[model samples]
Target: MPISTYQVKSFAFVVREGSISGAARRLGVSQSAVSQHISNLEATMGAQVLIRGRDGVALTPVGQDLFQLADEYASLDQRIEERLRGHAALDRGHLTIIANAPQPALSLIARYADGYPNVSIDFTLFDWSSAMQRLQERRVDIAVITEPAASRELYIRPITQSRYVCYARRDDDFAQRPVVHLRDVADRTLILPEPGSLTQRVVSKALADHGVVPRRLVTMTSFPVMKEAILEGVGVGLFLSASSVSERSLCEVAVPELDQVFTTCAVVPKHKLGLRVIKSFLDVLADSRA
Candidate 1:
């Protein structure tokens, strides 16, 4: 009689997962059952495979060879089942996307939602620092980040360019100013984004370049909160141009002399591309902008 496929699968899973307990959890069986499966496979082959250590299992030379063979078999099985399943389901997957507050990334996600009603999306709003934190922790599956950060384990894809704009309340006295100079605020109060955000950095550098420091300042990260600060005459706001759009209450102030624009990119775990839905959404985002 041929060896059972389940036992061989169990054996392969243990080595890949690095322990009997992990394999058991993957297989939804007891840890002892996983160990028994490995033992049975070793007995059937009349050769030792896993070299058991105090803490975990390691593959021997023969075990490594068999593990590769089993991996190939599993890959083939997955492909066959997926291909046989035919049309992909439109609805029924969860997508978590993180972006700086009210940026173009939000527009992209909204466009996708309009087309695919069944697929659910969770949108997280953060300043740049917290967005990077969520990406590193895998709290968000997709991240729209500024300036395209690179990490050894992450894949970053640049999708678009953005820039900072000064915003003031539509009816405010400053709204009629043809162009506001950076030095104009030297004696006035200002509201800034959280310290670590890209907008905050831009505003800080601009002030330093002009050799004018603000006398009074308020720092907060939320887009809506910053809007309130500007409207209430707390100070001026230097924020991403894309975030201030679609609102009649705020007016954009552009300074061409500065010639500064920030880029927003998408990032995800490199190995997660193997999953179909993740790959498709990435394609859609790239296509949406193109």
Candidate 2:
């Protein structure tokens, strides 16, 4: 008899998650059950597919060969189930999405919920690395990420491009200007996003290129905190245009040297393209673009 497809699926999840417990959580099955599936698969193949170690499970050379095949089988099974439910009115299925920036994702979510009232969305706010990790682990069905590093496992669709701008409280002197340069704020305190963020990368590079340095720098990890700091007359801060365009009390100033336009993309597992829920969200995204 051939190895069971269910067993293959369990094995695939283990490969993706790097631990049996993680795979069990993803499949909503017992740890013993997952272990049993792997044992059965190994017995059927007459090979030890996984080598358990202190760090986590590692695929044996044989296991590596089977991994891709198992993933393809799982993808085909998902597609078949989705097709069987064909045109079921987009009334069910929950989407797990991870996003780095909230603006475009929030906009997309609002519109998607409005059109498909029955579909549920679970959104997680994460940094770019965390978001990419979730996608690679198959924990999230979709990801809205900014400046994602190149990867072959993900299918990326460019959604939006955002430019950096400066925002300051209305009473601040820089608020009177239509544009702000890094050199102009050398003496003033500058509020900026935390290190390693896309916004920070763009802003820092521009300042370096122009050889301008701020006298004081306040680094914030959260956008709301940065915004609040700016609102309270803390300091002028760099922000993406999408985030600052609607601010009532903050003046927007263009940063010409920081002209880097960051592109945010919708990312999904390469094999999950045909899933109904993924298709539904992408449809909403495309419609929004139109």
Candidate 3:
């Protein structure tokens, strides 16, 4: 028997949304209906495609293979619906976006929202590792990432470039210097983002290469927290230049060892580039760059 498009679409939605109930809501069907479709899909393929867990659904090896084709089909279907709807399609839609940094992602989203107010957006901030993992899993419609790994499956466009810098309270002696060596901050209490973040990775490599180590380390979950910690005299913070709202109490200091420029890019699954919402967002990105 031939596989059904509906079954494949249901499976794709489950992967994209991360849960069957979420897929059901998107499909305007009951959760049981989505489950039955997934079951039927597995039976037809003669292999289990998904593993359900408390967190959400994960694709099995077979499911991963099937999803590429399924997602393309789903995207095409969406494109067709949008084309049939004409200009009205732009009036409302949904997009899922993830990012590692705040500047470009949040700014781009703000611009997109201004132009398409009715289009709902779900935006989340993630560390580099989690953001890349979600991008590879095809779970998000778009990701704005820093120094994204090259992949044929992804379509990437560079949005902006920046280098890492150290953040310190304005009154701190280090802030008075035009530039600080990695060694200078090594002896101070260093505040860094979570382990898998790009800032942590770059700082770790530079420290190892220069044979420097901080006297104490404080790990922060995000840029805002790191900034707050720095202001509170907890420690000096490391992050990309202009990653957060600048405060008069804080100053950015250049670290020549960490000066390697990093490019932040807008990324999307190549197969999904044609989807209306994704394309529309990319258009907004282009407008911003212009």
Q: lDDT of each prediction vs. the true structure? A: 0.72, 0.82, 0.90
Clashes of 2: 0
* Cα lDDT tens digits for candidate 2, 1-290: 58888899999888867789977976789999999999999999999999988887988999988987887777788678768887568866667787876778889999999988987777877766667766765656788888777789888999988888888888888888878888987998888878767777777887888888999999987567788898998888987777523678977788877777788899988888888878889999999999
As a TM-score, model 3 comes out at 0.93
Q: How would you encode candidate 3's per-residue C-alpha lDDT over 1-290 as one tens digit per residue?
A: 67888898999999999999999988789999999999999999899999999998888999989988888888888888888888554887889999997778999999999999988888888999999999988889999999998999999999999988889999999899999898997689999999889988888888999999999989999887888899999989879998876689999999888868899999998988877788889999999999
Distance from true position, residue 93, model 1, in Å?
Answer: 0.3
- Alpha-carbon TM-score of each model against the true structure: 0.67, 0.77, 0.93
- Cα lDDT tens digits for candidate 1, 1-290: 35787777787667645678877975679999888887888888888999999888777878877875674454345345545664276444556687876767777787777766676777767888888865654445688878746787578888777667668888866678877677766777878888778778777888887797888888986787898888777777777777745678778776554567677888886645555556667878877877
Best by lDDT: 3
Q: For candidate 2, what is the TM-score? A: 0.77
lDDT of 2 at 206: 79
**Residue ranges of candidate 2 with Cα displaced over 4 Å:** 1-3, 11-71, 132-139, 149-153
Pairs of residues at least 3 apart in sequence or in different chains that clash in candidate 3 = none
* Global Cα lDDT for candidate 2: 0.82
